[model samples]
Target: LVNGVLVAYGGMVPFIATLAMLASARGLALQITDGKTQIVTVPSVLDLGLPDAYVLGIPPLVLVFAAVTVAGWLLLNRTTFGRRTIAVGGNPEAARLAGIDVRRQRLFLYLLSGLCCGIAAFLLIVLAGSGQNTNGNLYELDAIAAAIIGGTLLSGGRGTIVGSVLGVLVFTTITNIFALNNLQSDVQQIAKGAIIVAAVLLQRRTVRDGT
Candidate 1:
């Protein structure tokens, strides 16, 4: 609601609106928590995040993620709404001319984003057994990088849920590998930036080749 109102009604670009949101929300959260981490003592919530809680060796969080992925995939690939979303992303003016309500669609997308954030927060609470205002700091970069690497065109016309999932998996693998090798944080960031650039360049070439 906040996102939709700000971006759709307030006439602010999504990036600027969301960045403002981040700052305001972060400030509010810090004021509420005094910039401290709040520990979770609930055994049930904490247990869900444990290694032994896996079914068939698949973590519960992975299951939740898979369910959400399937739902998103269906919504995006198997529905008229999804087509409209893609059309709007590819060309908003064209979509509006074609009778799609562009502002409404954008607002709906913002709402969907909020829902995803809620789900992510729940997962983080389970996995960490604590909550902190700083929990997701800088994660947006990884998300964007993953989407781009997953074959999501930077220009925003096309994307796939499965591809983005794979992209995030690749990004996570890189991070884990770097961490295991005891690399510095700066080095990891450099590697990630390089990967993003390479992915963009390859995508551009593909687009140019008309393949």
Candidate 2:
């Protein structure tokens, strides 16, 4: 319920949800790997989309992506639920002392993240033209890195959907530009690593200078 809202209405919620789902699915696979008379394969919704070029295919996805991002921003910035999330993330003890339900908050946070993953998983399959078992590998790392590079604190109290979006854009643009110029994958990887380190250091310097 709460998780559903977060996934549908929060930006990072989907990524979190996807990780949870993958974890659960792996568990299920393990439990049922040898127990069934028949195998059951789950098909995702995005697998059914029509084939088309990137220009045509990208529009609907972009629209859905934009809608999710905007909803996330509104939920985080303009809702009481968002306030409680911030409190819980910022300081669990303080939030509990202020009458917030810490367990509930954490539970919902994870649930919302799972739901977000479902939505994102749908988009990913469509974008990639296939449902792959290893499709989203390391996405969480990229997202977390983008967030950190965009000025989100690792200590977990302050962040924004807008900033995360911009961060993702910056990362993607840099990669795209490098690829267009025929840069090698190893060089691109090195460049990305350097950029992330530089970004983190700058963020720290900014924080220190602000004091």
Candidate 3:
């Protein structure tokens, strides 16, 4: 909510606000534990993360991810709010001119983002069995790379849940391959950056040709 207000009414850039929150949140976490990881011992939570725990041969976490993805797809592809979101993203001024409440849309979108983040945080805790401030380093880069690679326009205006999912799978595969090859983290970072750049260039070219 604070983040939404900051971006919607205070004219702050979304990325800047998110970055600040990420940094501050991590810092506060580190301070609380002096950089130690807190282990979670609850069996129920651990079951969600472990591979041994499965339902219908599918892991709980995977099911949660799939359900969320489907819900997102339905919301974006079949709902009025999704259209408004796209319009707001593509051009806030134009959306407002069209009688859409652009600021409110932005605020709601931010709230939606926060809700997703909370879900992700829970998943992370279950997966790791421990909470550490050091985790999720360079996650923003990974997220941006995945989205752009999945065909989500950097200029905003258009995005698809399926594309984002495939992008995540591709990125995860690349990460695993890097690990298998014993590549340095720096190398993986470089690869993600290159992917983003290439994706952006391709998007621009596609836009140009379309025009």
Candidate 4:
């Protein structure tokens, strides 16, 4: 849809379109919540069904994260759709010339991303017991930083699930270390920005060296 039309007619990059949508969605959510944080109390039955407690000596959330990581690895490494997605991201024109439906693949990728976001939101709400327009503010930066640090090319076509997981671990470790030191949010933001810049520079150097 909307993304297709924006790219076709408006000559907008898909990321820009998505960023616009994110802003709009956040605005709408704020209006719905009357600029107040909305608390969500899960019903006991639903809570019971969900992983509220530890399982197999691991926190349920940790288990869920592991499951998602494994599933992502399998999808990206073992599926035709994943191959097509990489192809499209790497070079859309070439992908189309190779008889791949580039538009369809892009659509599927966006759908998959949205599904992941939905799942993350569900997990966050469950963990926090609340929902707010600001719940994920600036999280896009964290995600991009993690991916790039993990060797996921911002230009696309190259990435590994394991690397991404490692990147997340790196980011988590940094955050925890900062928290332990009682650092300010400003310091955290500065560190994140620095990491993103460093990762991008490293990526450029690697690409230049053809590594």
Candidate 5:
């Protein structure tokens, strides 16, 4: 429905449209919860007993993350859909010329993204035993930062799941270090902004040199 409205209206790009939707969603959540956090009780199977369960002395969440990383890598590198995605990202006009249905592909991708978000939300709620309007505030920024740091082209075309995983680790490490040092949130934001700028500049340089 959001996509239909955005496409029909034909002004905002997907990112901007999504941002507006996010704001509305957050507002609705706040209204539903009366600005209070919602506590959730999950079945044991869904929880995976992260507080007690460990395999090879590794936390369940770490194992789950590793599994997801491997699955993402396989999907992106070993599937025809993945190849088409890369082609579309590299040059949508060329992809269309080559018989790829760019719109359909994008719609499928969006559905996949929603599925991932649903899964993430489930896991998050299970982990925290709660849900709130503020649950994923600023997560989009974190994801963009990670993708940039992971060598994903801002202009779109190239990326690696492995690189993204490493990028996430780097961000996580930095956040942990900051917390340990008792640094201010402002400093953390500054650091992240600097990293994003550097990544973008590096990508531009690479593109220029390639040309």
Candidate 6:
């Protein structure tokens, strides 16, 4: 987890710094060109300009994120491919008996997880208007915490995407409320940690009761 976070933050730092430099240059040029000057701004994505690629009426960020989420859901629930995933995650021995390749299922799951991470990183860049090394710091923890809170059994195989969504919303709501109250960042972090532990404990109890 630490390594993944470090790599993500490392990439983000340079990306955001470059974006800032590009924006600064654009602003400077616009200022110098004055109102009458027409500086045909050719979009260079490498420079962070809104390029023609963006003009192809690209799907909105929210839509893109939703699409990815739905794709993940369908991949886990609708396809024979998805059934194999559940089987492997639920019981490796049974999956093998059923002639499912456990290794292949796990590999696919990891690939899917990677794809989701990439989508999330892109969305973070778009939404922040700039990326920072600290951007998404500890986000993995947040995601896991949300999944657990949403009732994904730690033992695996019993979680729903809908439950994960609700968990994320619940976590967001708590943070939003704390921000509105002007709490310190440290306090919010502590609260989040406590909430995650409490949520997991409750979930464990529920699982134990076989509900």
lDDT score for candidate 4 against the true structure: 0.83
Order of quality (TM-score):
3, 1, 4, 5, 2, 6
Predicted structure with the largest lDDT when compared to the true one? 1
Which ten contiguous residues of candidate 3 have the minimum total lDDT? 47-56
Q: Give me the overall lDDT of model 2.
A: 0.72
lDDT of 1 by residue, 115-160 (tens): 9988988998998889998988878889889999899998888899
- Model 3 Cα lDDT, one tens digit per residue, 93-149: 999999999888888988988898788889989978998887777887888888988
- Comparing 4 and 5 on TM-score, the stronger one: 4
Which parts of model 4 have CA positions greater than 4 angstroms off? 1-11, 45-52
Off by over 4 Å in 1: none
Q: How high a TM-score does candidate 2 get?
A: 0.71
Give the whole-model CA lDDT for all candidates, comma-separated.
0.91, 0.72, 0.88, 0.83, 0.80, 0.68
Q: Candidate 2 regions off by >4 Å?
A: 1-58
Instruction: Name the weakest run of 10 consecutive residues (lDDT summed) in model 5.
Output: 3-12
TM-score of 6: 0.71
User: Mind giving the per-residue lDDT tens digits that candidate 6 earns over 36-148?
Assistant: 33333333322333333343566466567667779878877898998887777688789899998766566566556667877786666654454444445567668878898
Q: List the residue pairs that clash in candidate 3.
A: none
Quote each prediction's TM-score: 0.94, 0.71, 0.94, 0.91, 0.89, 0.71
- Off by more than 4 A, model 5: 1-12, 43-49
Give the per-residue lDDT digits (tens) of candidate 5, residues 1-211: 5653563245458877788888898899899999888876656744565656778778676677787778888888999898988998899899999999887777777666777677777667767778898888877778889888888897778999988988888887878898999989889888878888988998899889995
lDDT score for residue 203 of model 4? 96
Candidate numbers, best lDDT first, in rank order: 1, 3, 4, 5, 2, 6
RMSD (Å) per prediction: 1.5, 7.0, 1.4, 2.3, 2.5, 10.8
